[model samples]
Target: MLNRKIQPASYDINEINFITPTIHQFKNNIPLYIFEGGDEEIIKIDFLFDAGNYYSDKFLIPVITNAMLREGAGDYNSEQIAEILEFYGASVRLTTNRDIAIAGLTFLSKHYEKILPVFEKIIKEPNFPEKELKIELNNRKQDFLIENKKTRFVAQKKFLELLFGKTHPYGNYAELSDFDEITNEQLKNFFKNNYNSKSCKIFIAGKFNSEVLKFIEKLFGDSLWGLNTEKNIIKFPIQSDINKIHTEKWDGSVQSSVRIGTLCFNRLHPDYYKFQFINVLLGGYFGSRLMKNIRENKGYTYGIYSSLVSFLNGGYFMIGSEIGSQYCNDAIDEIKKEIANLYMLDTNNDEIKMVKNYMIGQIMRSFDGMLNTSETYQTIIPYSLNEKYFY
Candidate 1:
């Protein structure tokens, strides 16, 4: 039974400890990190690579190559692979961002042996068949067309291009012609160059034991797979303009979306933690200054927020919102005022304390379960960091 009327206690957290996993490296340079917890006989393995937008020599090639991996592989066609995964109650995901791409899979421990072969096919034997490649390209082209028509999408895409220059990998976007230009041969070449076993690490989380470990080692350990992929370096510099405002007109539009941001630092910078703390006070939360001023006080829009986004090469601070087209100027004015206020006025100790508490709670929410905990650790591995940083 729980108390209904009594006041809850107020407490402070002194330290946080994460149950970091045990690491086991395979014969091939693939490292498997195992987080052993949870009641159900399920395990999720995440394969992470430094292959993302920034790694591609051509626009959209890295992501397109990653997405096509599951379309056809080995002897199984797209539909057949889907049916097999579904029959085993397994799930597969392939996603990419500016910094990296991840291929994830989850299944019951009982079906581990049965499901392993299918994943092996996806990893080592992706065919990048022509029919499937064409279908994927056409569908993506349609999505791009639809997305470009949306005001928010236009604002976001234009913002990135402006921030990183039209030619930068992180800043550039694909044209419809670019999608049409992709060939199955290019996809095969890109996949071969990027998705090698040597470039990835495996994160396994859930109720797993010695037998499960043995099974993974037997299947993946002895095999000689993956291309020797070195970390990419851009010989040229990526540049961004300052104090830029871009306005794109969409006829018959009822609202205008706005993005205000500039190039900043990556997570590896020493300023990362303090900048994040300052960001929470500025606009990182619902109770942040931007939301309080722009949305609640002035009713400029239903929502407005800011973020200090971290990436592998660099990061940025963006303040975004969708408001009535007429009031877009007013909202921008108010946002500037809020920033000026932060600079002109003395720092508020109380605000910092409150934000600290709120961020602690947010961190707690992120690690609330076993799978989430494993995923949390998975994020840190790419940075060459470990659980010790958090502890």
Candidate 2:
């Protein structure tokens, strides 16, 4: 113990094993994954549904529908629901992304029974009251207006529209008119079709016992609910923009946001992880080539990043930064130069080793706690992959 000069032995990250949760099915065939481990009595439950934008035929319907679920439900109004959750020291989160929507609740295990019934009302019996819907839409419209003024927001939005055509579910964005045009009937219809018990998956993490399991089964799995409509398998072909380059000018802006990217493969592709490893060498981390060249060496901006983003239908490789308007051209040229360097020059062993160590640490961080491990598994569930993907 006193020999401080000698270093401790190190093991490869590949030697680490991820704990797989015990998978069970509720009576209605809803998948329940339980990861039970924690010193505290807190528990987290996530209900994932196929009710994302991909399933919506209209803009803003999926997200607005998901958000409005909590505004008013069965016997309780929004304020009553809020008061109940606060009294029980519970937190609720409802969000929709491109491919899925999630309703998450976190609270102490002692309050589980009391809070779950309220959640059930929110999930199954939302009324989509007109007054609440009007308020939510107006607030969201204001946020959209504010975000639309920023160069970064404009660049990001256009980037997606260009990467996948403006009509594709993953690429489409909302206009202000959408707020005025959307109807409650559409929200109800989308919710009825996509949030059915059959297509939902449940994930629970932290200290939970058999009683909690039984209660969940009794409430959510005892019988089929919602419209119980079979899910539609819809596919949209990628229709990327033909133009290689385009620009938009902001009247009174001193900074320019730059986004350069191309379409890539989804996580299901065999080479996804390998390409992600290479992407890290380029810009996936702080010590990456893009950071060293663009930020530290040239002082182009405070930071720059490259990512290999995975999605349900497809993925993309993007490099983004906000820089002084004057340096925009120079920065873009430098980025291309860096890519050329990667292609023309061989990476030295030292850089490769550093990146490898960084990624290993990242993988370890992703599974640092039981809840975090559960969250990591969530990313893979949509792809029908298992915990062994970590290996």
Best by TM-score: 2
TM-score of each: 0.94, 0.95
The candidate that wins on lDDT is 2
* CA lDDT for candidate 1: 0.82
In Å, residue 198's CA in model 1 sits off its true spot by 1.6
Q: What 10-residue stretch in candidate 1 is worst by lDDT? A: 242-251
After superposing candidate 1 on the true structure, give the runs of residues whose Cα lies further than 4 Å from its correct spot: 1-3, 229-232, 247-251, 344-349
**lDDT scores for all predictions?**
0.82, 0.87
Cα RMSD to native, each candidate? 1.9, 2.1
RMSD of 2: 2.1
Global CA lDDT computed for model 2: 0.87
Clashes of 1: 0
Q: Give the TM-score of candidate 2.
A: 0.95
Which digits, one per residue and each the tens of the lDDT, describe model 1 over residues 269-333?
A: 87777788778888889988888888898987888878898787787888888887888888888
